[model samples]
Target: MTMEPIGTWHGVTTDELGCVTHLELQDNRLAGEIPPELGSLSSLVRLELTQNWLSGGIPAELGNLKNLFSLSLSINQLTGPIPAKLGGLSRLFTLYLGFNQLTGEIPPELGNLTNLNGLFLAHNDLTGHIPGSIGNLEGLEFLALQGNMLGGEVPPELGRLADLRHLSLANNRLTGRIPSTIGNLEKLLDLELEHNMLGGEIPPELGNLANLRSFSTRGNDFVGCIPAGLRTAALNDLAELGLSYCT
Candidate 1:
């Protein structure tokens, strides 16, 4: 219960915390680590230590916080890896390290945070592949690398995330097929490639995802049937369609 040391004590008021610039200590049960002098708070901009119980390993001096833009260390109990100097926080736009216990890989320098729009590394224990420099994060719009233990395939350069909208590589250990340039993510809406080891068939150009809403490929190794434009009506905002244990 003696946490102090965030910055400028002696009577508070940089809005009750001294020279503050948005530092939300989420779920405040804050534990340890994460104080490399808070990277000298070079005018921080949104740093929320999420759902506390924090452990160590995320302070590569926070890349000297060149004006951070939303960095939430998700549900803590942190582990290693993931600090490729936080890609030097080039004005990061929301980077939440999901449900912690993090491991290696996934840091192709976080694709140099091209004004990233939400990139949460799901669950954790991440492995390799998936970082074709994350297709240089073309203004990414919510991409959770589901569960984790990620394998290859699926990165048809993430179809160049033209403002992607929720694309989870479910479970993990991904395999081949499914990337017909992912129908160019026409603003995709929830497309989790169910438990991995994927196989051929299913990409009828993802029925040109007319803003698909939740489309899982079930336990993969797909074989056929289901791609009738993802069962017509241009996916009519389909609500959770998992191709039950594909043939």
Candidate 2:
């Protein structure tokens, strides 16, 4: 007989003062709405409950975790808009709320998280333009906003993230030309913008992103020859290139 995947929730940790600091319960077979009382864990530093069967709107009370550094609740059946109150997380480093049934536009209040390093909100029902305020995150390294219903032009402000390594805005309803500003992310490693309505020639400035490895603009209205800089194999050791259906 096959053994059941271990579902015991056992990574709880506490500080010397007896305050709960970490609670990890990924794949724990949890169900029902998250408890609002969890917000009372005033000393909590990290809380993760990914890959479970939880549903219902995310409790706004979670925003009360003033000391939280990381929060992961992906791969669940959660719904409703992300809590704008979460913008108050001044010390947050990584925030993962992807692969849920969340709706509504991402709250601009999230821009207040200047200490954020990674932000993942992909594969949801989110709509509206990419928030320009996100450019305020000077230390951000990873940003994934793919597989949503967001529209509008790619914000030029995104180019401001100098430390960003992975940037994906793929499989959305975004329009307009690829911004030249993106080339400024010299640290970018993987960039995907496939299956959108974006047009115009791929910016030649993109060739300047020496660190780009996986690049795709495969399904759009773009016209013009692929830039010569992209044809060179040595300059950008790309592991994957999806230039189909757009050239």
Tens digits of per-residue lDDT for model 1, 31-89:
98888888887777888889999897888888888888989999998998888888879
Winning candidate number (TM-score): 2
Assess every candidate by TM-score. 0.35, 0.89
lDDT of each: 0.80, 0.87
What is candidate 2's lDDT per residue for 1-247, written digit by digit as tens?
A: 4353222226778777767789998999999999999999999999999999999998999999999999999999999999999999999999999999999998988889999999999999999999999999989999999999999999999999999999999999999998999989999888888888999877877867887777777677776545544543432312233342223
In terms of lDDT, the poorest run of 10 residues in model 2 is 237-246
Per model, state how many residue pairs clash: 1, 0
lDDT at 21, model 1: 73
Runs in model 2 lying further than 4 Å from the true structure: 1-9, 231-247
